[model samples]
Target: MAKVGGVVAAGFLGLSGLIWFVNLPYPMIRRPVAGIAPMLLLPSYLSMDRNYREAIAHVEQADQLVNQATSAADIGLGAEKVKLAQENLDQLPVWFLGYEPVRMCHFMGCSWNFTFDEFSRARAQVGRMNARIFQENNALTQLQTAETDLQKAKQAYQTATNVSQQQNAIADWQTALDQLTVLPRETLAGTTGATKYRNYERDFNRVVGSVAGSNQTQTMIAAAQQFAALATQNSQKSAYTVTEWQQIETLWSNAIDRLQKVDSTDPDYLAAQSYLADYTQKLGVVKTRLETEEKSTLAIAEAKRQTQELISSLPSKPNPDERNRLISRLQGIIDQLKQVQPNTTVYAEAQTLLKQAQSKLSQL
Candidate 1:
């Protein structure tokens, strides 16, 4: 009977120790057990290491999804992954083992070497992923709203019979475009919005320009004034590309056309005439700038072509005639570079080439 009681007591203690070992990674079990037998807390450290690695894997997966997400569905999936990662990280006892306890555990041949810093960094990565997902979802919503607004504006513009209605529709259209413009470009929705914006702007300009020969003189004058203002604003800016200058030129032309639509019998005919004169002058100026930009671009291209040819054909040992020919051609290239006007898109490039050409000319 004594031997049986001793065996039974030993069996109970063994089972209790096994239960305690299994649950030591958890705070509730580790708090009491660690106070009495801190050496046995190795299981808790091992569990923490495992959780940290799992959280890291989840974070990486979430990051990949968020970066490549093209739709709301993708963002939703990424959010789930990040949330799981956060939950896993939350299981770590960062406060409990952050100092002396972790250092002591390191001496016990336990391989759980994760630091508080590593844990914090992993949490921060998860946080950033969550933020990106939130931003992407918000961008998607904005895109949908912008698209709806665009459709409404188009419908209003197409059905309007009077100038006031058309003007209001135009305002709505601009607001829609503004929404698209402000979307975060790193997001999928923003990229889609950009493409839509380009198409919308082109179509809107074409539709606005199509209004002509209407008896609504006030409408014609108002449209003309708006185009004139846009043209002036664009024209006053420097460093416009050739294509940009051409668009500005088109604006001026559109303004002039609108003013010409005003009938002589209309009440606003005199005002339209005044606007026509001013717009025509601005159109002429825009045309001049366009011409300069084209000529300068052509000059730079021709200079580069000549320089390349000269480089390919130059003799290793040149006589006076060959040397003189090279110098003449280089001088011509320098002249071409000098023709590129300031405030043109290619002006900086041209200036850089000009210095090289001048230096080469002197060397020749």
Candidate 2:
């Protein structure tokens, strides 16, 4: 009885040892299939044989990985590499998520050629490409530096709560990040630049947008009208210096440029168009007035020069009729100059000319 029991125990122990030995390489065998995963290249599946939640979840996971791959491709990882990686990752058994591996063991099955060794080689190929990006694109380093600058600016903005300081900090952050464009190549920078600019633009516009708000249309209209009013008033009075007139025109021009940028999608697009037309019309009137003022000034100058010549060539003996004509011409020039508003530079010239002409006439 003891000998039979000993033999049975030895058989049981040997079987257990054999089982452990067989399973020892299981972990190693499972790696490549799991590692390359949905990212590994596989034939397109007509149906993954998964329930709705599980299927959708797998797709979402694949999408995220593919998007990252696309970003990686921009830095020189070929698109095909990313596509193959995604294919490997998107399969079952390896990424079964829930269903039994045996159930999915159709077509190419899980453990056949899709083992850890192949996955490792594929992953290594991809990993090598990803690591190569930092080497090939020197701008990748510059991009990182710009990002650090943006972070610093953000910190400064946070520390300074004042609106002005915040605006400055935001502007600095944007400028620093914009420097990335010159450094980073388009392959990598295109997507990143767009994303970074979009984010910074949003932050930059926070104060601006809040201030503009729903009343953008109303505010634009009011500002335009006010600018028109000021310009028209100055032009009508002819009371502006050349420099002053130029400044007014510049202000109006800047306003128009801003109005043109009003988004077509804005609710007030039609209103903006109407206001733009009206402002343009007003600007035309102002331009016309400026031309008229300039022509009038030339006429006055001509009249003054002719009168001065006439006065200098006057007869020493009385030529009452000719003297009367010269005085009358000078008087006309003075009147023309005075007709412009008190603010007109021509008005001051007019006063001086009038005094001289009057004194001359009295002496004659």
Candidate 3:
């Protein structure tokens, strides 16, 4: 019975020692993907699932590539590799954060955490991430600059009052659109930025079309205004020859034609219509004045011609009757010229001729 009791005591002690050994806290060589149960069952800490270790190992490989890079051109390739490593780390499940004992914390202070080496390897990719961010920032800046230029062009186009100005601004807008590829990709900055630029492009084209219509109308209005000014100048003249009246007709007609060409949709179309009515009325006034002037001009020319012939035909003898007859004829010519009015352009010349004839009569 004593020997049997001794064997039983030894067996109990051995079982306790085995349990302690299996449950002992061990240091992590690599982070494991397996659950706590498997970590407890496996003899080696790294022997179960090792997906976390593989992901972290990718980060280390990327770091090696980054270290080999010497120039700015090589940095792009290195950043891509680093992004791959980041993708792997992102794929890791949340449960992969592991718990283990290290040399500093033997029994109670230990907790679930990333392995020190794995965390450092993942942290090493931060520089590469920063590089990619900087590249994106530069691209975004260029895009914004180009976008601002496009905005100015669009504004100029919308506000321009003439065809030439609108055309120049539209050309600038086209150039800006051509350079749209300089913008950073949506993957780099975001979809929002790219979407904003696209909206600008759509709005710009719409505004340009409106501007083209407006400018076309403005161009026609300008052309009409030039003709209208000339018509006004000619209409203000107190005297018009038959040829001058014909020229006035041409100017008024051309001005009306241009005004008629103004689009009905134009903002100034109603004003143009009103101008057409006003010009038509003025043209009638000018035509009436021209007819009166033409009749008066013909009468004045006949009287002057008859007076000059009589003055030339006067005898060398200073007979009172002959002199009186010549003076009466000269008075008739002056009376005809007085009807021409001082406001008339030919009236001044007529007055000079009247003064010369009166001097001849006074000498006789």
Best candidate, TM-score: 1
RMSD of 3: 36.6
Q: Which residue segments of model 3 deviate by more than 4 Å?
A: 1-219, 230-249, 261-268, 281-300, 318-328, 358-364
Q: What is the C-alpha RMSD of each candidate to the true structure, in Å?
A: 12.9, 28.6, 36.6
Go through the candidates in order and give each one's C-alpha lDDT.
Answer: 0.79, 0.56, 0.63
lDDT of 1 by residue, 126-216 (tens): 8888788888989999999999998999899899999999878877876776688679888989888889888986787677653422323
lDDT of 2 by residue, 162-186 (tens): 9888667766665565565455333
Q: Which stretches of candidate 2 lie over 4 Å from their true place?
A: 1-238, 318-364
State TM-scores per candidate. Answer: 0.48, 0.33, 0.34
Native-referenced Cα lDDT, model 1: 0.79
| Model 3 Cα lDDT, one tens digit per residue, 57-152 | 655665555545444344566566667666655544333344442432344232224665655656565555556546655655666677787888
Question: Which portions of model 1 show Cα errors greater than 4 Å?
Answer: 1-47, 96-112, 161-163, 208-364
Clashing pairs in 1: none
Could you tell me which 10 consecutive residues in candidate 3 have the lowest summed lDDT?
A: 27-36
Residue pairs of candidate 3 with colliding backbone atoms: none
